[model samples]
Structures are given as C-alpha cells and as structure tokens.
Target: MCRIAGIFDPVAENLQQRIEGMRDAMHRGGPDSAGVFVHPQLPLALGHRRLSLIDLSEAGHQPMIDAELTIIFNGEIYNYLELRSTLKHYGHEFRTESDTEVILKAYRQWGVDAFEYFNGMFALALWDERNQQLILARDHAGIKPLYYSTDGKRLYFASEIRAFAHAGKVFEENSKWRSAFLTFGHLPEPITTLKDVVPLQKGTALIIDLPSLHIKEHRFFEWTFNGKLKQEDEAIALMRETLEQAVERHLVSDAPIGLFLSGGIDSSLLTLIASHTRKDNLHTLSIVFTEEAFSEEKYQKLIIEKTGAKHQSFLVTKAIFNQQLDDAMQAMDQPTLDGINTYFISMYAKAYGLKAVLSGLGADELFGGYPSFQQQKKMKLVEKMPESLLRGLQRMPDHRLRKLSYVGLQNSAAEYLSYRGIFTPVSVAALLETTEKEVEDDLQELSAYYPVQGLKNGNRISWLETNFYMQNQLLKDSDFMSMWHGLEIRVPFLDKEVMLMAAAMDPAIKFKKVPPKYPLVKAFENELPEAIWKRKKQGFTFPFEGWLKENEYIRPSNNAEQKLYQQFQQKKLSWGRYWCALLMNRFTPLP
Candidate 1:
C-alpha cells in the first residue's frame, strides 16, 4: 500500500513544490520513501510515497522509469513474479525485481492490454513520453483508491482527497453529498464530498491523450455472475481450491504478514488454510473489549490454540476511544460512519511493528453472509402488491414493511438502501435543509451508476453488496484507514481469481449452506474449530454504544445531530445512525 499524486496542467506553476506537498500530505501511507517525477518538455508530473512491501531495496523506489515510460504506482502487484517470468520470455529484461519495474515492463510490452493480466490490487499512473499519453488505473476490486478532478484542460489525481488541499485546489460540495451519505451511511464511488473529484471506477482505466488532453476510459475486467452452472459440491470444491491459491498468492510478500482474526467462519477458514500450508507460525490480531458481549476473544483464542499462531490483542476501553477519536477522524480521508474499527486495528498493528495483515472482508459479500439474501426471498410476497399500495406502506412503523415500500421498481439502489440505508429521503432533506424531491432525485441517479441489470435474486443481492456496499464503502474505508497507519490490510476474499469463481456459482448452493458463510465453512469445516462457526454471528461490533454517548468530543454539534443524539440516548437509533449523523455535522460543506 502506498500513495500517488500528479498534476497535468500545461501552464503549471511551482510544479516541484506542489507535487511534493501533495505527496507529503499522504506521508502516513508511505513513510519509507518518497519521490517526484517531472517531464522536462511536457506539462506533466508524478509523485509517489512508498510503503516498501515487495522489495526492500532502492530498486523498489517508484516514479520508476524505463526507456520512454515513467510511472508512479500505489498497491502491490501480487502476481509480479509470474508476470515477470512471462515478460522475460517475451524478451523484456528488467533491471530490478520490484513490482513497480515489472509493471513498467508489463505496460511497455502489452500496451493497455497488460492491465488485464494483472491479478493484484493497484492504482497507478503511467506516462508515455513518446505517445504523449497518460494512463490512470485502479485495481479490479477498488481495494486501493485513485481520485481525479478536472478543470478545463487540466487534471489532478491523488490517492487521498486531503492531497488536493496541498495543490491549492478549491473544494465544492457535490450536490449528492449530504443526500447520499445520509442514505447510505457512506459515500458511493465516483462521488465524494468534493464536487469535482470522482473515483476512477474499479477495473477501469483512463487513457488521456497529452496533445489534446482528451480522455478515453477503458474497462479491462468487470465481474459478472455468468459462469456455467456447477453442482453444489463441485462449486464448493473449486471454491476451496481457488481460495487456497488466492491466499498463497496474497502470502507472497517480502515482508512479514498476519491475519485480522475476527474469529468468524470466514477468517477462521483462512487461518486454518494458512496453518496447513505454511511452516512458520502465523501472526494474528484482534480487539478485545472488557464488555464480554461485544468481544470475540473466546473464538479468537480457539483459532490461536488450533493454529499455534502468535496473537496480539488490544483491550479497548472508553478512555482509549476518547483518546483515539480525533486522530482516527483525521485518518478518515472521506467522512465515513464505518471503518473506525479498522483504523484502530491498523494503529495497533503499526505499533506492534507489522507492515501487513490479512482480512476476511469480502468473504461476507461474496458468500452471502448478510440477512439481505434471505430477506430478498421473503420480500417477494410484498412484491406481489401494486406499486401504489407498496408506496402507501412507506410510512409504516415496521422497518421491514417500510423497506418493502422501496421495491416497486427493478432498482439496485432501492434494494441496497432498503437494507443498509441510514436515512430516508425525507429525513436527509430535513437534516440538510433541502427539498425531499432533490434527495429522491439523487437516489434515483445512483441506479444508473451501479446498474446490476442482468443479475437476479441472490445473485443480484450479491452484486449490490459487492459493487455498492463493499466497493464504495468497505474497501475505500479500509484502504484510507489502514494505509494512513502504514499498514496494508490485504483481503484474500476479494482477489480476482477468488471473487470471479464465487460470482460464477449458483445462488442456491452459494448462499446459506449454513447460517453465515457456507462455502468457506464447507471448504474447511473439518480443520476449523467448531466454536468459530457454532457461535452466533456478530457483525462488525464495537463498544461504541456506550463509548460514543459518553465521549464529550463525539457529541452533537448541530441541531440535527442533537436530535439524533437524543434519539441515540433513548435507544431508538443504532450507534451507526448516530455516527453518520455526527459526521454530517463535521463534513457538510457550508454555503
């Protein structure tokens, strides 16, 4: 994990200072090294901050150049060794064993087609001096972030939004900012707090022509649930094999690695697999709460005892939450209601001197770990009613009936918002002092951005969870929060090979062979400890229910937040709703 930034203005001023300032703004992501590349004749510059995961030598330094090609990269090319071999066979020699160099040669050898061959997480910018072109690309899963803003003929791209401040960029609030955040509890991709900046979509690249400054987008990989149907057992067997291969690929780090052992079925399965494969003892980490109800220490211990992995536990208390809140807030590149737990875990990992850790983040999204899968099936009874009758139930007292009100149309946004939305359009408008129609319009616009037209039933739900929830929120938050602590949170579940295989399976067998995660459990049920899977699944939890209400700094700052906080204290709203309400107060742009 690293940070990248660059400027593409022909009449650029103070290029050196601006690029370096932008890079340094994100220094926490990559404190190991920093560099800037500027073309002598062209109005282009690239900046990079290196975390040094792959190669621990000067050869790993980025702003890496070969012949007429210059590049700045952030994230690991996990399959660089395999790609390097292929490149060498094709008569492409390399001076360094670094992934950055491998990428440079790969891009040189295959042109834009090389991106399709890459198997790991990455956000990169390549400058072709001869062709007078620049290519900006993000990984298939959006595990790493790359944001860009365009003003007339100029372009500014960076790994973090805070970097834009260093370049003296003006920040305008996106029209959808308040509405989307309130509805989703997180900002969806291609949309940020800033009006001008948007994420380069996952699995897509922007090819910019330097001469005219025109841009053309190229999509190298897009996941579709269109694989040939397989038997339940066959799919499970292939899934296990694919996951093992993915984990082995993820473990191919020059630096030491560990797992964020959540003690859930997904993480426990990975732990068991890693234990069987590796000779050395595994390293695992988790947060333990004094409040036993919220702590998974028992299950975590079971995994530790089974694998004999070296484990570290951070005992969290209210005092620690109060002490860490402000700094963690700074780590939030974009205001998010989730990912606070990830930030704290990353901080503990960094203090323990670990550079990288594995997480089972995408396992739930890929393997139907959410109630939405079952809920979708039940909603068909409600779906039988007329559209007008459904809309009449929008104001119902029961949450399920209210969610059913959103199902009149074939809409991904409606389905996702029904399950995970933070606020209704009316509430968002009231909070932001805007019209409800405007908020409704903004929500409608999201459907076009994440259209899962071909998918159906559980497959459709999986697509929405993976692309909308995981892509826009979980992955983005995990990247900023962990990388800000200089810890690379590697997700084996989200790997290209693993995700595609999971996406291909039929929903009948893919979802709920057990309560939470079936494929992962079926893959390793024998070796994995029973306590890990037998226990009731507690989705991402923190002691925030008590901690946030007690903390002075996290309290209400505005009228809307005050009302939300009062409801929070009354036990009417979950900690997550109150948390997002808190951030809206902090991050909302002024008129």
Candidate 2:
C-alpha cells in the first residue's frame, strides 16, 4: 500500500538525501504523496511514499510521528478498527482514523507484543525514541517484503531491494544466490541476489539498540500443521466461517475494491462472499487470451452471471504481450521467473482506477489444490530404497525422471524441489559457471531454511508449498509487481486467522473430493455454481510460450544461456526453465 525506507546510524551526515533517494526509487508504489521524518536526537530518517488507500487525507500520511514513536509502515491492518476500539477503552487516543495510527497506539498499549494482535499483511519500522531503539517487523505470512543491509556504520532498510542501490549501497553479485535462483526459479527468503543484503524473515521482528548497535531478532510466528483434529462436518463449518470473516475484513478499504477472478474455485468463492458483503459497484477483473486454450473467459462469465457483479476484461494477444513485455520487464525490481502475470493484472487494475483488489493467491497451498499434494504420497515409496543407492542416484544424469528419483530418496522439501524446481543442481551449475558440488551445497543450505520440519505427507507438502513457493516467489512477486502499479492486492486466504484454521484441518479433508480444495468446495458447494466448482483446476496463466518467440529483448548471449535458449527454441525446454533463463539474462546479465 506504501513504500518505506530508513537509515539508522549515530553519526551519518546528509541522511535526508539518502532516505529521499530510496523513497524516490519506489515512487511508483506511492505516487499520491511523500513524507520524510528525521529523528531529533537519533541519527535516523524515515521516508514514506503514500498511495492513500485508507483515510485519503493528510491524516493518513507518514512517516507518522507522535511524542514517543515515529513509524513508517507498508501494509494494511485489517483488524485495526477492532483494535482501535479496544485501545480506546484502554485510554489510548487517536488523531487519524487510519490503521497506521492504530499500529502506533497498539505499540503504545503493548510493546513488541503488539505484532501477534495484528491479522493483516505488513512490513513496518517504528523508531521508539522512548526505548532508544528501532523495531522492525513483518506480517505473519510475509505477504509484504522488507529488505535491509548494514556495513557496521549505517543500516539501510527499504520496501524493495532496488531501493538499496539508490540509497548508496554497492553490492557485488552473489554467485550462491544466482545458483539458488537458477535451481529454484527464484531466490528463497533471507537471501537476495546481492551479497550481504537480507530479507527480514517472516513472522519475526528485528530490534536494533541505538548507540550500542546490538541487533536481536524474535520469531513472532511460524505456520505449523499440528493442530487438534475436528470432525469433518465441524471442520468444514469452521473453515467457511473463518473464510467469510477474512473476506469481510479485507473489504475494509476507503477506495473502491475489486476481485481478480480467474474463474477458479478460490476466486469465485471469494467473489461470492464479497458479493454478500458489498452488493453494488463490486468490479471483477479478468484476462482473456487469444490462445483460447489459455483463456478462462467462459468460466469467468459463469461467475459473473452468478454474482451479477460489474465486470472488466483484458483481451491479451501477441500484440499486447509485445507492447507490454518490455515495460513489465523494466518494472521488475527483482529477478523472477513469475510475477509477469501479476504485473500485467495490476497494470490493468490501476488503469481501471481501482486502488485495492482481492486475489485468491494462498488458496492452493492451504487447501491441497496442487499436484504436489498427490505426488507426495508416491514420493514416500523412496524410503524403502537403500541410502547408499540413493546417494549414488544423486549423481545420475539431471533429467525429469532423475529429479523424481531424488524426491523419493528424501523428504517433503526434496519432493517439492523435484516438482517445483526450474533446473537441476547440475543444470544450475552449468548456467551460473559454478560447480555441481557448489550448487548442491547451496541447495543443501536452502533446505535447512525450509520450514518443513516434521510434517508428514500432505501437510509436509503444504508446508513446502506455502513456505518455499508461496513465501519466496508468489508473495514477494505479488508485493513488488502489484505495488509497482500502486495497487494494493490483498490475499484473504493468507490471513493469519484463516491460515491458523487451515493448519488445524486434517490433511485427509483437504483433497477428499475431486478437483481438490475439498474443504472449500464442499463448504460452499450449494452456493458456488456447479459449472464453476466442478471443472478441472486451471492455473492462472497467460499465453507466454507463443509470445516468447517474438520477443527479441530476452535473447541469451553466452554459451550457458544460449544452450538453454536453444533447448527452448527446440521446444525441449520446460516453460519454467525458459522463463528462468530469460529473466536471469534480462535482469542479471552474465558478464
């Protein structure tokens, strides 16, 4: 919803210019207004770029400061109204009817303990003058991103990694992260393409003590699948209720809101619920492709007819892709194989004058809607194989079948890698000019960061999908791409309360029915149109393979990239692999 940047040091001079540069780099994120706050005693400056979603007045402006604390926040607190009421009863006062103010008051009422009380996506930094320390925190689900770097002299933090360069931080290309990106199609969290720059972990808070410069981190939340089981009927009812509440809470915005309907169960269900909450002026946005195989216009129409909501559609063709591809690529602040879909969709939403929209992003990970869920069962058969044989198989030729071999030899993270990875360790080594052993070592380090601890089967797969894929790729991509167009894309399924409810669900209930997403489809079966819920699940995608042929700006140069590109031209390369190569070449060209 906004862009925030700050620099903290006890003796840095010309701090305002540095903060302003970071703020200007994120100008697209918040074109409505800009503000900069310089701390009186502490050598700190906070810069903000505002899009004006909530209050639409000067009161909602930031870097908002009171007597005790000054804060720069980038997110929405859905439960702010409720928290504000509670804080008022506790004798807290407010000047603006904005969630930004609510966060300040909440922090006043309780210290860092206030993060657990919030149930929305956020990445924020609050300078606590009273405590003589600075506190930075991210939302529980990592829906928003915060990037930071330090040189033992000054600490710089921003909403996007690109802003760091404008803030005068030089970073050499990181080979390990390049290898990781080539392997996974995106870099995992807490790692960036630049050396020494890091993403603050999700569900965690970072505190920097002012003069001493000591930093301590606290993990405020982590998603787990182990929860008390409930009866089938009871679980379904609770999921429905929780989802409805999450949708309603997301509807709390001052500007007009819309839905990105993919004509799938998740978006349709959200539209159905949102229709009940806001009957009029509920716009739904969709994209139809000239390649009919990639179009969901038919199902989009079905949902439109059922909800009777105002509809807008973008007809994407080769010309559209050609015209928009370059700009979209330039708009990317980070290198990613995905998010081109999000970038185009958010562009259309902004052109339609909608400030905020709801997207059904996290539904697949939470409800077992991906093939990885079913594949996890088959992957378990690997446990019967001998460890010596499995280790030998790791040296096998890198191919689709060979990757599947690795999936069986290990656990959920390995299975997820086989299913979701873009390149094998050998392939990444070749591409990044690194050794296969180094790539393997980087992957091993990445696996250690994976949240899949002791979860089993479907739950383990869910953990990997949510933590590895959703957290690293989907959520980060959604944030930068959408925010690039100054649009706020809200994900109700990623709501902390909703995620908690889903985590408590028995894995047995997740895909018990056909088309997967068993609990969601069953809970709303009567309400959802049969034509919509009964169809085979289709991913939200555009016709990229055809367009890639015509786009010359994405060509590869060196032997490594050229090799991958040649395979793509021969149609032997997977789209994921082609995309990975194209983006890497486009963004971080090989020197």
Model 2 CA deviation exceeding 4 Å by range: 386-398, 408-412, 589-591
Worst 10 residues of 1 by lDDT: 394-403
Deviation in angstroms for 274 in model 1? 1.4
Q: What's the lDDT of the predicted structure labeled candidate 2?
A: 0.83
TM-scores, all candidates, are 0.96, 0.96
Error of 1 at 395 (Å): 3.4
Candidate 1 Cα outliers beyond 4 Å, as residue runs: 392-401, 588-591
Per-residue error (Å), model 1, residue 279: 3.3
Q: What is the lDDT of candidate 1?
A: 0.83
Worst 10 residues of 2 by lDDT: 404-413
Residue range 1-591, candidate 1, lDDT tens digits: 689999987777888888998999999999899999988877788999999888889988888888899999998888899999999999988888788998898888889999999999999999998888899998998888999998768889999988888775577777778778888888887678888888899899999998577899999998888756468789878988999989988887788788888888888887877887674758888899999888888888898888898889998888998898888888888877888889889999888778998899998788888888888877777778898887676566544456566676455688787777777766677788998678777877777788778778878888889988898889988998998898898999988999899878877778764745787888776787777777877876788867766678666877767787787777766677777877877863521
